[model samples]
Structures are given as structure tokens and as C-alpha cells.
Target: MTEKIAVLGAGSWGSILANLLDENGNDVRLWSNSEAQAAELNDHHTNQHYVPDFHYSESLTAYTDLAAALDGVAAVLFVVPTKAIRSVAQQVAAVLQQTHQKPIIIHASKGLELETHKRLSQVLAEEIPADLRQAIVVLSGPSHAEEVAKRDITLITAASEDTKAATFVQQLFMNDYFRIYTNNDVIGVELGAALKNIIALGAGALHGLGYGDDAKAALMTRGLAEISRLGVALGAQPLTFIGLSGVGDLIVTATSVHSRNWRAGNELGSGQDLKTVIETMGMVIEGIPSTKAAYELAQQQSIEMPITEAIYDVLYNNADIKQVIPQLMRREGKPELQ
Candidate 1:
């Protein structure tokens, strides 16, 4: 069956996923807010600014009109940044209401709403009414856009309360080089996906400061503890922290050179100001905002996330990274499982 799918966002991850869907024999409409981007994709089948030296599937089309891109689609994938999710969802809600089309809503964005500290799934569900959408799903894991574009063996999780909806997504994207696993623990999956970026920022900062491997390993291990701790406090499954969305995502994001969060952290650790690094990155480094959201959430939940707090101090309070390191080290340690 050739399903018509609308992938909303024309950035690197969005373009890659849209092309993959088109390659999987779907009628894909990639929505970009920029007219130039739409024209670039439509005319030359390339999104060079975001994914350089890559060609998109010829059949994949790009659209500037929201209604046209969403017309008669079976599924809508929100691939925009975390901050843009709600606004885009609002636009989609209006369009769906006008067309009377109900499609499964899936999002690849991994971050919390800064103001509300809600998961991206929760943000989508809030703006798009239940009547206008079949189900809300989160597709996340360790996969990166550059690797997926190369057709590297990539595995991810499709999570939703609706098993059939998740299965629908699993079947939609799985191929020779791509694999999808379905998980019911949406809270854990989303938390792990969002919080790992914070840890990645810390890892990058460690590398920037010329810290050795032992320090990097300790930060990641203790960072996972903090992620699992806060996640479980918010009613997530404890075991889910050990799954692909949890430890798997943490490892890749914290260690990979392709990670924007890590790169941003590296710049910060190397003594570049946050504003300058963000202005120069040319892409959204999700960890900066995620650190703020997670830090505030931790305070509200009364959860102790020391590594998150340390990173937060450096990013927000203008604390010195060298000084922050020793402070984190001086904290009285407890049992590993605690």
C-alpha cells in the first residue's frame, strides 16, 4: 500500500526521514516553511544546506503550504525542533479540522517544552485535538541523520500507548538498513531521549576541557543514574532506562562526533560563549534548552540530578567549567544503585 505521508520540517533529520519514506514506496510530502528550501527540494531534489552532498528521492516533493502538504495523508510526522512543535501542531490542527482528515501523529523531536516542561508527545496531543488525530507516537533512539543518510544499520523505537499505531510506524520505516522496535513506555522513552542530550553536552564539555576517558566514563554512568532517577520519579518504568531509548541513546549522543549537543558543549568547554556557539552552529543544539527545562523540572520534582545541575550552572549561571568539575567531584558519593 502506498501511503501518503506528510513530514513537517525540512531540516537534516526531517529531509532524511522523508526521503527514506519515499524510498519505502510512500507518497511523501515534505513541508518546509522556507520557500527557497521547498523550491530547492522540488527542483533539484536536494537539501544541501541541511544535508550536503545528498540527493533526495525524485518522487519526494516539498511544500510551503501546510494544507497542500497534509492533504489526504494517512500520517503526519512532526520533525521540527522542540520549541517549534507546539506552533506547528497548532497549524496542523487548524488544517486537519478544515479538511476533516484524521492521521496518526508521530514526532521525531526529542526535547521538553521549555515553558511547560512537558514531553513533545504531550505538547502535540495538547494542540491537536483527539478527534483530529488517530494516535500520538514518538520515534526516537540512537540514530543520527548523517549515518541514516548513508544507509547505515540504524535501529530505533516507535512508542505509543496504541500498539497498532506503533506497529503501523514500525512497518512504515523498517527496511534493509533500518529497524524499528515498539515500546509502550512513552514516558521513559521520551525522558531518556530528551535527557540524554544534557549528558551529551556534559560529555562534550569534558572533552573540550581536556578531561581524560575516566572522567568522561564517570560522567556518563552517573548521568544515566540521574536520567533514570528523574524518569522513575515521574511514573516511568525503571527498567525502561536500560533499553535502547535510554542507555542506547545516551551512549550515541554523548559519544558521537555528529551530535550537535556534544559539539555545542565542546565549544562551551573550550571557553566559547554560549551565544557565539549557538549563532555559529547553523543548527539547533537541543541540549542547551533541554538543560534549562530538565534543571527546572528537577527542582520542581525534588529530584536530585547533580550532573544536570552542574551542567545547568555552567550553561545558565556562567559558572566556570573548571570550577564546576571539581565541585561535582567533591559531592559525597552514595551507592551506585541509589
Candidate 2:
């Protein structure tokens, strides 16, 4: 059976997933808020703003009309930034009200919104109509959209309270180059995806400060501990943090050059100001705000997250990044895994 999928947000991640769906024999309609971007994809079969070298699939259609994209769609795939989830979900809900059937939503955004401090899935659940929340699923992993679009081997996970929804999404995206796994721990999956970027920024900062393998290893370990503490505080299963969504994502984001957060940290460590670095990258760097949010979350939950706090101070308070190194080392520490 051919499924009709509406992919919202015409960014690299959205385009890659839309291509994956097209390869899986689904009818994909890609919707971009920017009409110009939609037209470019519709006419040129390329998202030149993100991935230009790859060819777009003929089975995919691009549209600026939200209603047209949602019409008769079996599933909705959201690939926008975490900040845009609420407004987009509200639009989707309004459109679905005029439609005959509600589509199952599968999204791949990472990062919690700063204002409400809500996770993407939580925002969707709060904003989308009650009936649609049950069918929501989140897909996340160490996937760099550019690599995935190039047919690189990328493994990801689909998580939802509804196992059926997870399985359906897994089947929708699995391909020769893209592998999908199903899990029911939405909390763990989303947190793991969002929190790693913050830690990656810390890792990059350490690297920029001329730290070696020993320091990097310590930061990664402590970063994972901070991630686990926040996850535990937020009702995530303990073991999930050790799995793909947690350790897997942390390793990739903290180490990969493709990570925007890592790159930002590298620039910061190399002594570039935040404003200058952001202007140079010219793309969304998700780690900066996420670091602040995670720091707030730790404080609220009474969870001890030293790495997140340290990064938050360095990022916001203009705390000396180089000075924080010895400060962390001097802290009276207890057992490794307390």
C-alpha cells in the first residue's frame, strides 16, 4: 500500500526524510513555510539552501500551501526547529479540522522550547488536538541530514507511547542506507536527542581550550551523567540513557564535525565571540539555548548537572571558559557513578 506523507519544513532533515519516504514508495508532499523555497524544490528538484548535490525524488511534491500538503495525507512528518513546533502544530490542527481524517504525526526535531521549557513532543501534545496526541511519534538519532541524503548508513529510532505508531514510522523510513528501530520510551528518546547538543558544546569548548584525550573523556563521561540526571528527573527510564538515544547520540554529537554545536564550541574555544561565530556559521546552532534550558531544568529538579551548569555560565554569564577548567577539577568530587 502506498502511504501519503506530508513533510513539514523544507530544511535538510525534512528533505532527507522525504526522499527516504519516496524511496520507500510513499507519496511525499514537502511543505515549506517559505514559498520561494517550496517553489525551488518544486521546480529544481533540489533544496539548494541545504543539500544541493543530491537529486530530489520525482515521487515527492513541494508546496507552500499547508492545506494542500495536509489534504488526504496519511502521516505528517515535522522537521522544523524545536522553537517552531507549537505554531506549526497549531496550523496542522486547524487544517486537520477541515479534513476528513487525521494524519499520524512523526517528527524529527530536537531541542526544547525556551519559553515554556517544554520538549517538542510535549509541545505537540499540548498544542495539537486531543485526538491527535495519541498518534504522535518522534524519530531521532545521530543522523546528519547531509550524510543521510548522500545515502550514508544511518540508524535512527522512532519512539511513541503507541507502539503501533512507532512500528509504522519505522517501516515508513527504513531503507538500504537508513535503518529504523522502534521504542516506546518517548521521554528518553526526546531528552537524549535534545540534551546531547548542550554537552557537545561543552566538549567543543574543552577541545578549543587545548584539552587532550583525558579531559575530553572526562567531560564526555560527566556530560552523560548530567544527561542521565535530567532524564531521571523527567521520568525517563534509567536504562534508556545508556541506549541509542542517550550514549549513542552523545558520542556522535560531541565528536562529529558535522554537529553545529560542536563547531560552535570549537569556534568559542578558539576565542571567537558568540555573535561572530553564529554569523559565520549562518545556520541554526541549537546548543546555546538548550544549554540554558538544561541548566534551568537541573536547578528546578534539584539534580546535580555540573557540566550543563558550567556551560550555561560560560555561555550566558561570560564566565571564562578557560578558567572553568581548573574550577571543575577543584570541585570536591565523590564516586564515579553515584
Candidate 3:
């Protein structure tokens, strides 16, 4: 069936996903906040800043107005950053309220809200009226926009409490190259998606500090443990941590060159200031803000996440990564599962 899909946020992930859908013969409307960008996408068929070296599907359209984008769309995919979620969602809620239409809400962004520490799904559920969205789907895994744009094989998870909703999303995007797995564990899936960036940041720092592959391996393994611990405390299945969204995501984020969080950490470890790095990257390095939320949440829940705390100190307290990492290594050792 031909589906009308609205992809909000014309960033790398958004543009790529929209392009994939268009390639699959779906009528895709991609919405970028800037009117100029929308015009560029519509006319030139290229969003060079986000998804460079790739041509967008010419049939895919771009829109600046939320109402126009939502008109007659069966589903809306939010590919914006975490900080922008609430604002964009508010606009979506108002439009849905005015139009009296319900659309399946799917979010690909991964990051916890800074202050509230709410998962992206929780944030959406809080902002949009329940009547507007029958269910919210979270799409996440080890996939990168650049790699996915190249049609690299990607296996991601679409998680929702509603199995039917998840299955709908799974069927929407699965293609020859992209595979979707439906999971009912929304909390664990979202947490694994959001929290892995912190470990990626730490892993990048280790690489920048001239550490070997052994350090990277250690960080990924221990990071998964902390992520599992905090995720389990927040009502996620412990087994979910061993699955694709958990260890799978951690490995890719912590090791991949395409990761923004890893790049940001690399710059910071190479002695650049966070402000400078953020300005230079010109991308949302989600781990920076997510680290703060995870740190605060860990403290609130009385969960001990040593690697997260070390990364938090380096990023937030201006602690020297070289010194702080050693302290992290010298911490009291216990059973791996404890």
C-alpha cells in the first residue's frame, strides 16, 4: 500500500529516512524548520549539510508549515533533536487538535530531557493529547544516517507497548537493506538508545587520549552494565539490555566514526573546549546533555554508574579526562554483574 508519511526535522536522519521511504514508493513530505532548507530540498534535491554526498528522492517533498505537512498524512516521524522535541510536539499537538486527526507518532531521536530526565516517548506522551496519538513508536539501534543512506544493512528495533502499532512501523520502513524488529519493551529500547551515547563519548575520549582497543572494549562492556543497571531501575526488562538495542547500540555508537557523540568526545579529549567543539561540529551531540540527565537520574535513583560519573565529571565539571579516567580505573572492583 502507498502510505503518506510526514517526516519532521530535515536533518541527516530525517532526510535519509524520508529518502528511504520515498525510494520505497511512499509519498513522503519532509518538514524542515527553515524555509530556505525546505526550498533547497524541494528544488535542488540535496541537503548537503546533513546528508552530504547523497541525492534525495526527487519525489520526496519538503514543507515548513506543520499544518500543511500533517494534512492527510497517515503517520508522522519526528527526527528532530531531543531538546527540540517538546517544542515541535507542542506544534504537532495543536495541529492535531485543530484538525481532529490522529496520526501514528514515531520518534527516532535518542536522548533524555535535560531537567525532567524523561524519555523521548514520555515527553511526547506528556505534550500531545492522548486522543491525538493512539500509540507512540520509538525507532532506535546501531544505525547511522550516513551508513543507512548508503543502504548498508541495518537492523533496528521499533518498540511500543502496542504490538500492532510497532508492527505497523516495522512494516512501514523495512526494505531490502533496512530491517525492523518489533519489541514491546519500550522503556528498555529507549534507554538503550539514549544512554549509549554517553558511553560513546567516553569511548571516543579514550581513543583521543591514545588508549588502545582494549580500553574501548572495556568502556563498551562496562558502559552496557551501567546502562542495564539504570534501565532496569527505570522499569525496563533486564534481558532487553542484552539485545540489539542495548549491547548492539553501545558497540556501534562507542566505536563508529560516524557518531556525533564520539566525534565530540574526541575533540574534547584532544584538548578542545566543549564550546569550541560544539560550534565546530554543527550537529547535536546528544551525549553532552544526555550525560547530565543520566548522571542526575543515577544519583536520584541511588544507582552507581562509575563510567557515567567519570564522563560526567569530564564534561560538566571540567575535570581532566586523563586524570579522571585513571581514578575510574582504580575504583573498587566487584563482580561484573553486581
Candidate 4:
């Protein structure tokens, strides 16, 4: 049974997912915001800007129009950068009015918005109609698009309050090289997905500072602890942090060369300004704004997240990263878990 799938955003992740769906025998439509990119995918069967070295299938049509892509689709996967979630959702909502049967919407992005400070799912809920919001699901993990696109072994979790919605997405993406796990902890899944990028920046900074495995390990462990604390405060199950979305994602993003956040932090740690780092990266570095939102979430929830605060200060307040490191080390000693 082939499902009709529409994936918005023609970035690496979206193209990878589109390829995955096509391999799984689904009718995949990949929508690019830019008509030129869409035409490139349609005519050349390649997305050179993002997923280079891979050709899309004839089954996967690239459309610049949202309604044309959504037409007769059973599922919609949003894979744009986190910052573009709202704008894309609003456009989808306007076009989806004619279709009474709303497809299950899945978001594969991994950051919270800065101005709205909303999660991807929250953005979907607000922009998509209430009826359609019921089908919102988050597909996340440490799986990098480049690896997944190359058909490497990858594991991800699809979470939704509605079990059926999650299951639908799981069926749409799961294959031999890509494994899918279904979970009901949407908050924990999304929070872990978004926050790991922030921690990855910290890890990159540590590595850039010439710190050995011990410092990286400490940062990773403590980072997960703070993320779990904030997750618990925000009504997510504490144990969720121990699962794939939590420690799993943290390990991958923090260590992997594919992580933009880690790479950006590496540049910053090596004494580059934020502007310089962004210019060098040439892609959406999610950790910058996510760090700010995580800091605000920590303060709002009255949870202690010192590492996140330090990262926030370094990114937003222009605090000196080298100076902050020593300040963190000099903090009054306490029990390890206290």
C-alpha cells in the first residue's frame, strides 16, 4: 500500500526523506519554496544546493505551489529550518481549506522559534486548523540528513499524542537502512531534539578549546541533565531524556562533524565572532536562537541550567566565552548530582 506523501522544503533533510519515502514505495512529492530549485529537482532530478550526488526519483515531483503539492497527499512532512516553520504552515493552511480530509502533518525540524519562542508542533497547532492540528507529529533523532540520504543505518522516533498519527509517519519513513521508533512523549522528543543543538555548540567549543574527552564528556552529561530538568518542568516525562531523543541525540550532535551547531561552536571557540561564524557556516545555525529560548524556558520554569545560561550569554549578550569557562569552573563546589 503506497501512501501519497508531500514533503515541504527541498533542503538536505527533506530530500533525504523524500528519497526514503520513494524507496519505501510511497508516492513522494517534494515541495521547494523556490521555483528554480523545484524545477531543478523536477527536470534534473537533483537538488544540487542541498542533497548533492543524489538524483530524485520520477515518483517524486517538486512543486513550488503548496496546494499543488498537497493535492491528494496523505501525509505532509515539514522539513524546513525551524525559523521558517510558521511561515510555511500558514501558507499550507490557506491552501488546505478545499481539502476536507487533512493529511497527517509531520515536522522534521529541530529548533524553537526566537520571536514566538514556540516549538515546531506548537507552530503547527497555531497555524494549521484545529482539526488538522490533531494530526501533527514530530519526527526527530540524531540522524543526520547526509548519512540518511546515503542510505546509512539511522534510527529516529516519531511522536504524536495521537498514536495513529505517529504510526502513519513511522510507516511512511521506516525502511531497511532507516529504523523508526514510535513514542507518545511529544514534548520530551521535541525538547530533546531542539536542545541538543545548543549542547552540541558547547561541545564544539570545548573541543575548540583543546579540551580532551573528559571535558567533552562532562559537558555532554551535564547538558543532558539540564535538558532533562527543563523537560520535566515543562511536563515531559523525566525518563524520556534517557531515550533516543535525549542522550541519543545529544551524543550524535555533540560529536558528529555533520552538525552545523557543533561546527559553528568550533569556529567560535577558535576566536571567531558570531557574525564571522555565521558567514562561514552559510547555513541556518539553529543553536544560536535555540540557546536563547532554552535560557528563557529555564528561567520561566525556575529550573537551574547554568551551561545553557553560559551559552546564551556567549551568543546573545556577547559575553567572552573564554572568560565564562573559568567562571563556570570557579563556581562553588557541590555534590556532583546536586
Candidate 5:
């Protein structure tokens, strides 16, 4: 049976997923908060601003009305930036309360909430009525929006405490080109997804600062160790760190040109100021915010996350990026894995 799926946020990821759902023979309603963007998508079947060369599925419809897009949907896939999750969830809760509809909640954007340091799903649970949705699923992995838009072989994980909800999401998104895996480790999945962005930022900074592959290898290895440490402290299974949501995600985000976090860090390493980089990129770099949140979390939990702290200093404190390289190298010698 085909389900009516509401895709909130008309960014590259959201648009591509909506098109994929249409391809999978589902009724997809693509919602954009911007009226102008919604009009362009509906009239032109394109979201050229975010994905300039990709074509959207004509069968998929676009809407500016949140309630209307979700009118009869079975699930919602949120692709907005991390900062926007709370506001959007509140709106969804209001709409659902008004319409008395309960849809499976799924989020694709990554990054923990600032100050609160809550995951996207956690934020949703706090804002949305508990009876609105039995469980919230998180979709995350190494897949890039550009490649996924082209139907490249991409794999992502759907995670929730409810295995049934995760499996349902896997079934909803899986196709010939896109594979989905269901995991009950929501903590591991979301933490891996959010934390890798910080590592990716460091990787890009290293690249921009003229470091070679050897440096990147060391950075990723150590980055994963710290990620695993923090994650395990927060109740994530250590083995999950070696899986798609962990190692797989770190490799792709740290290496891919399509990653906004990598690109932003590249600019920072190239000597651009944070304000200028943000203005120039014209998109949300999840890593920057994630770095801050991770840094705060590490301090509160007393977890050692050196890479995250270095990146946070660079982004928030105007610390010299080039100088931090030797500083890291000069740190007292320690075992490879702690």
C-alpha cells in the first residue's frame, strides 16, 4: 500500500528524498517554509537553489502550508537545520493537535541542540505531545544529498528505541539504489551522525592547512576514539561505533566535497572568518554548531575530546587554526586507543 509522506524542509536532502519517495510510488508532499521556494518547486518541479542540476519528480507536490502538506500523511521526514528542529516540531505538534493526526516522526538533519544538548528526536519528544507519535526515528549515514539525488548506491540507518518503528522506516525508504538498515541503538546512531561532523571539520581544516593523508588518517582514528568514548558514556554500544552510523559516517563526511561541514572548515583553514564563511556558504554547516554542543557536552561529562575542543576554539574563540596543528602534535605521547 502506498502511503502519503510529508517531507518538511525543501533543502537538498529533503527534496531528493521526496523525489525518491515519488519514485518508490508513494504520495509525497514536499513542504518548504518559504512561500517563494514552495511556488518555484510546485511550478517548476525543481529546487534549483539547493540542487541546481537535479530534477524533481513531477508526481511529488510542494506546499507552504504545514498542516496541508501533512493533512493525510503517514509520516514526516524533517530536513531542516538543527537549530530549527524545536520550532518546527512545535508547529507540527500544533498542526497534529488541530487535525487529530498522528504520523511517524523521522528526522534527517544532524546536530544536538545548543545549551540543552538534546538530540533532534529528544527535542521532538519534549515539544510534541507524547500521544502524537509512539516513536521517533532518525535517518542518518554517510550518504550525501548530491549523490543520493543521482540515485547512487547509498545506505542509511533508521534508528529508534522501537525496533518496529525503525523497521517501518527502513521499508519506507529502501529501494534498488538506496538501502536502509534498521537499528535499535538510537543513541549510537544519532551521536555518531552528529559527532562525525566535528571530525569532518577537523579533516577539512587539516586539508586546507596543507596536511597530507597521513595526518588525516591519524585525525580520523583519534576522532573515532573520542567519539566512541563520549558515545559509550552516554549509553551507546561500542560496536555501533564501527558500524555505518559511526566509522562509515566519519569516513564519508571527512572525505566528501559535498559535506557543508567539510567545506566550511576548509574555508576556515584557508583563513576566512566564521561570519564570512557562513555568509559565503549560504547553507547551514552542521559541524560548527555540533562542535559547540559536543564541546559543551564533553566538558560536562568530563570526556576527553581534543579534536572537538580544537575545532570549537577555532570556530568560537578566533583561535589560530594553523598554530593548532603543531600544538596537537606536541601533546604528550599517548597510546593509539584509550
Candidate 6:
């Protein structure tokens, strides 16, 4: 069956996924905020600004109007940044209300709402009424937009409390190059996906500081501990931390050059100011805002996340990266499992 799907946000990840759906024989409507981006995708079958030198499927269409893009779609994927999730979800709710269409709501975005400290799924649920959506799903794992654009083999998890919903998403996205796994641990999957970006920033900073593989290995190991601690405290399954969305994502994001958070952290450790790095990159470094949210959440939960605190200080407090590294190293040693 050829399902009509609405993929919101024409960023690199969103555009790639939209193209993948088209390849999988679906009617894909990719929505972008900019008229030029929409025209580029529709006319040239390319999104050169985000994913350069790549031609998208000709059957995949682009739209600037949210209502028209979503008209009669069976599923809607939210791929916008965490900061924009609420506003976009609100608009989606209004459109669905008018059309009386209840579609499956799936989000591939990671990171919590900075203001409310709520997960993206929670924000979507609050903004998009249950009556207007069949179910909420989260798609996350070690996949990167650049690699997926190359048709590299990628595996990701689709999580939802509803088994049927999760399986439906699995079937929707699974293909020869892209494989999907279904998980019922929505909390763990979302937290694991969001928190890994913070640790990836730290890994990049280590690399920029001339630290070798040993330092990065230590950072990733201890970083997973911090992630598991906070995630478990926030009602996630302990075993999920060891799954694809957990350790798998941490390993890939922290070690890969394709990660924006890692690249941003490298610049920070190389002595560039945050403002300069952000402006030069011209992409959202999710770890910056995610670090703040995680730091606050750790304090509220009384969970000791030293790595997150260190990164948070560097990003938000103008703390020197060199000084922060020594401070982290000098902290009182404890049992490794604690």
C-alpha cells in the first residue's frame, strides 16, 4: 500500500528521510518553511542548502503550506529542532482539527524542551490532542543524516507504548539500507537519544585538546554512566541504556565526525567562543541547550552527573574548557559503578 506521509521540517535529516520514504514507494509531502527550499525540492529534486550534491526522488513533493502538505496523510513525522517542536505541533493540531484527520504522530527529533525540561514526545502530546492523533512515536538511534544520505546501512529504533503503533512505524521505514527495530521503552529511548549529544560534545572537546583514544574511551564510558543514572531516575528501564538508542547512539555520536555537537565541542576546546562556533557552523548544536536541561534535571533529581555539569558550565557559564577539564579530573574518586 502506498501511504501518504507528511514529513515536516526540510533540514538535512528530514529531507533525507523524506527521500527514503519516496524510495520506499510512498507518497511523500515534505514541508519546508522557506519558499525557496520548497521550490528547490519540487523543481530540481534537490535540497542543496542542507544536503548538497544529492538528488532526491522526483515523486517526492515539497510544500510551504502545512495544511496542504498534511491533507489526507496517514502519518506525520516531526523533524524540526526541539525549540520549534511545540509551535509546529500547535499548528499541526489546528490543521488536523479542521480536517478531522487523526494520523500517527512520529518524531525523529531529540532533546528536551529547554523551558519546560519536557521530552519532545511530551511536548507533542501536550500540543497535539489525543483526539487528533492516533499515537505518538519516537524514532532514534545511531543513524546520522550524512551517512543515511549515502544509503549506508543504518539501524534505528521506533518506540511507542502502543505495540501496534511501534510495529507500524517499523514497517513504514524499514528498507534494504535502513533497518528498524521496535521498542516499548519510550522514556528510555527518548532520554538515551537526547542525552548522548551532550557526551558527544565532551568527546569532541577531548579530541580538540589533543587527548588520545584512551581519554575518549573513558569519557564515553563514564558518560554512559551519567546517562543511565539520570535516565533511570526519570522512570526509564535500566536495560534500555544498553540498547541501540543508548550505548549505540553514544558510541556513534561521540566518535563520529558527522556529529554537529561533536564538531561544536571541538571548536570550543580549540579556543573559539561559543557564539563564533555556532555562527560558523550554521547548524543547531543540540548539546548546548540539552546540557543546560540535563544539568537542571540532575540537580532536581539529586543525581550526580559530573560530565554533564562540566559541559554545562563550559557552554552556559563561559567556563574555560582547559580549566574545566582539570576540574573534572580532580573530582573525588568513587566506585566506578556508583
TM-score of each: 0.99, 0.97, 0.99, 0.97, 0.98, 0.99
Model 1: colliding residue pairs: none
Candidate 2, position 314, lDDT: 87
Model 2 regions lying over 4 Å from their true place:
132-134
- Please report, in order, the local distance difference test score of every candidate based on alpha carbons: 0.94, 0.86, 0.92, 0.88, 0.90, 0.94
Q: Name the better of 2 and 6 by lDDT.
A: 6
Give the C-alpha miss distance for residue 36 in model 1, angstroms. 0.7
- How well is each residue in 1-338 modelled by candidate 1, as lDDT tens digits? 57999999999999999999999999999999999999999999899989999988999999999999999999999999999999999999999999999999999999999999999999999999999999999999998999999999999999999999999999999999999999999999999999999999999999999998998899999999999999999989988888889999999999988999989899888989999999999999998889999999999999999999999998899998889889988889687778
TM-score of 1: 0.99
TM-score attained by model 3: 0.99
Model 3, 1-338: lDDT tens digits are 57999999999999999999899889998999898999989999999998877888889999998899999888899999999999999999999999998989999999999989999999999989899977999999889999999899999999999999999999999999999999999999999999999999998888888899988998899899999999999999998888889998888899888999999888888888888999999989999999999999999999999999999998889888889987987888788779
TM-score of 5: 0.98
Better of 1 and 2 by lDDT: 1
* Backbone atom clashes (below 3 Å) for every candidate: 0, 0, 0, 0, 0, 0
> Where does the lowest 10-residue lDDT sum fall in candidate 4?
94-103
| Root-mean-square deviation of candidate 2 | 1.3
Summarize candidate 6's per-residue lDDT along 1-338 as a digit string, tens digits.
57899999999999999999999899999999999999999899988878889999989999999999999999999999999999999999999999999999999999999988999999999999999999999999999888998999999999999999999999999998999999999999999999999999999999888999999999999999999999999999999999999999999999998999999988887888999999998778889899999999999999999999999988889888999888999999889878
The regions of model 4 sitting more than 4 angstroms off are none
The alpha-carbon lDDT assigned to residue 141 of candidate 3 equals 88
**Comparing 3 and 4 by TM-score, which wins?**
3
Ranking by lDDT, best first?
1, 6, 3, 5, 4, 2
Model 6's alpha-carbon lDDT is 0.94
The weakest ten consecutive residues by lDDT in model 1 span: 329-338
